[model samples]
Target: MPDTSRTQLKQILATRYAYLVRRLERITGSKEGATDALHETWLRLDKANVSTQVANADAYILGMASNVAIDQHRHERRHAHDDDVDVLLGVPDELADPERILTARRKIDSLKDVLRGLTPRRRAILLAARVDGQLNREIAERFGISLRLVESELSAAMKYCLQRMQEAGDPYTDSRSSGPRKF
Candidate 1:
């Protein structure tokens, strides 16, 4: 890519960084959880041939950003050394393979559309609890709702997520299927 186009891509990423971060945070569940993932994503996007799509620049960027985030998460889980205590406690090693990243991006994109059918609050609450590591009381406080409401909303939200994941063949149903996965 040309220098100017690379600068343009940087500008787009810097401007839209927060939006991308928040979405990834919802998925990864923590601000730090997605920082590296997103940074790696930017590096990949900058290297790709996206300069011709200036007509829908933002969409292209967001698509690339989302894909980058998913690939990072998948890599963290798939690494053979992730089970090692020291490595596990440290940052998850990043995946630099384009093909692996592309595959992860496609699968995650499919799930993203499925997740969109949920109400904003429902999505927020579930992601906050499951991904962001927030407790029910914390979620309630964050949303300015009562604890009882968080409990109930989470109950319904978990059920909905479980059903959706089941239909989508998401690993979430197979893994966390005991507590939060209960439908």
Candidate 2:
């Protein structure tokens, strides 16, 4: 609970409720958990005996939501079900085959090697775009390069990775040959 009046908390929650839910979802890894945490947050805020005026209502509410999420995580950890025992009790295992797992590891290793072989700038651009989920424009701004250059580097890196994957006999490769296919 934050040191804010209930009225202010309610107002902040009303306006930015959706955003808070999305943030909580990112923290909790599921919509249901986020919803539950939000509900708990509302309840806690309603019962909080705070009289001090809050300078920033949004920050206060976000803090409360974060606390609720942490509590929910702790509760879940306490009651976590053992997967091994559950599997013995007729829970269907959608586990991957050992051969498939081995193939995946090999492909991952090959991709890592290919990425390692790239120029530093190209590798950084590709990682910023793909792994960090940065937009090309953002990468361009961050790297102090033109957007076109960023796109070119990213594309070249992707092509190299795809070519290496094809050479490694990647099952997901559309064309059977390692060479470029006629689209």
Q: Tell me, by lDDT, which candidate is best.
A: 2
The C-alpha TM-scores of every prediction are 0.40, 0.55
Lowest summed lDDT window (length 10), candidate 2: 174-183
lDDT of 1 by residue, 66-128 (tens): 677777768877885735867667866577578878978867786677568788898888889
Deviation (Å) of 77 in candidate 1: 24
Assess candidate 2 and give its lDDT.
Answer: 0.80
* Candidate 1 backbone collisions, by pair: 29-131, 29-132
Model 1 residue 173 distance off true place after TM-score fit, in angstroms? 2.5
